[model samples]
Target: MAKIKVVLIEDSVVALEILQRLINSSEEVEVVGTALDGASGLQVIEQNQPDVICTDLQMPGMDGLEFTKEVMKRFPRPVLVVSNAVQPSDVDNIYNLMQAGALDFFPKPTSGISTDYERLKSALVTKIKVLASKRVS
Candidate 1:
């Protein structure tokens, strides 16, 4: 089967690199494109036409909420938000992102390059694959 293509939108260079590496490690998924901010993310999306979108909640030009809305209006892809703001305690943030059209959420690993990060790889890839199968319009 063809690997699922994914586009990543994150402002943090470290986080972006880590996410790309983690997602690429999965044989079932691949990071097709990446952008530092939501504006550039849209362009990448247009070019790649990925199966799923992984985005950070906070960005310089356009935040994930606004980005998700634009993406739904323009491209219409399953968007999985990977951000620290989506923690269970932040119900409002999570609800808003979902309301804006995000299909799912994954809390950004805070431990940097550590065991916790490594352990999250499977979960992250699972989320991506699940989202890839979702129908978003």
Candidate 2:
């Protein structure tokens, strides 16, 4: 089967690198593109035509909420928001992202990347695969 193509939108370099490594380690998913901010993310999405998008909620220039709206307006791909702000405690942020067209949310790992690698990788890859199968309009 073809790997699920994913585009990551995150402003943190370290987080981006870790996410890329984790997602790429999965045989069923691939990181096709990445961008530091929402504006650039839009460009990358246009170029990649990814099956799913994983993005941070807080980013410079344009936030994930706006990015999700724009993406739904333009490409209409399923978006999975990965962000610290999307924690269950932050109900408003989660609601806003979902209202903006995000299909799912995953909280950013609070501990060291390596410590959470195995579990995070499994969850992230599963989410990407599931989202890839979604039909967003």
Candidate 3:
């Protein structure tokens, strides 16, 4: 099976490393590019033209909501919001992100690393695969 190309936009260094490791462990997916902030992420997305984008909602600049909007307006690719900002109050923000064109969401593990690491990996991998399939179609 050809691997799904993924671009990850995350501000936290540790989180980015962890996510890259976890996602790359899946033979069906590959982390093709990464950016520490949404602005840089946007440039990366444009340059790489990834199959899907996995991004965080909170950052120093551009934030995921605005980035998603711009991405949809320009690139129009499948986007998955992977962030720690999915609290109750953030529900509206999540809705806005979806409205801006994000296709899915993944809650950032509160404990830094997930206790059920395999489950998280499986879920993320599954979502990426599903989105990749949709993109292909």
Candidate 4:
């Protein structure tokens, strides 16, 4: 079986590291590459051609929604927007990202793999695996 390649984009170093580890532990998914901002993430996707994208909504240069719109125009891969910040004011941003072709969103874990680590890992693995099917040619 082929592994699902996932390109993760996040600004927080801690969140980025944790998410990398979490996703890498899954047998179905592999962390192909990572980026600190949306622009870099988009470039990485264009270069690497990953199977899925898990990005933070708030990032420098482009941000997640802007990146999603640009990505949809060209790549059109499955994008899962996972963020640590979840405020009511972000509803429109989230909605726009989805409308722009994002696949789904999940509230990032508040703690560093402490608050229900296994559950989060399982959900991520399951969700990304399903999304991978849609990305493959």
- The model with the greatest lDDT is 1
| Alpha-carbon shift of residue 114 in model 4 (angstroms) | 2.2
> Which of candidates 2 and 3 reaches a greater TM-score?
2
Better of 1 and 4 by lDDT: 1
Off by over 4 Å in 1: none
lDDT of 1 by residue, 91-119 (tens): 99888998999999998865455766657
Q: What's the lDDT for residue 135 in model 2?
A: 98
Report the candidate with higher TM-score, 1 versus 2: 2
Candidate 3: the clashing residue pairs are none
Please give the lDDT score for candidate 2: 0.92
TM-score for candidate 2, residues paired by index: 0.96
Instruction: Arrange candidates by TM-score, descending.
Output: 2, 1, 3, 4
Candidate 3, run of 10 with poorest lDDT: 107-116
In order of listing, the candidates' clash counts read 0, 0, 0, 0
lDDT score, candidate 1 = 0.92
TM-score, every prediction: 0.96, 0.96, 0.91, 0.90
Ranking of all candidate structures by their lDDT, best first? 1, 2, 3, 4
Per-residue lDDT of candidate 2, residues 1-137 (tens digit): 99899999999998898889989999999999999999999999999999999999999889999999999999998999999998789999989888889999998765476776898899998888889889999
* Global lDDT of model 3: 0.87
Count of clashing pairs, candidate 2? 0
Q: How many backbone clashes are present in model 1?
A: 0
How accurate locally is residue 73 in candidate 3, as Cα lDDT from 0 to 100? 81
**Global CA lDDT computed for model 4:** 0.84
Winner on lDDT between 1 and 3 is: 1
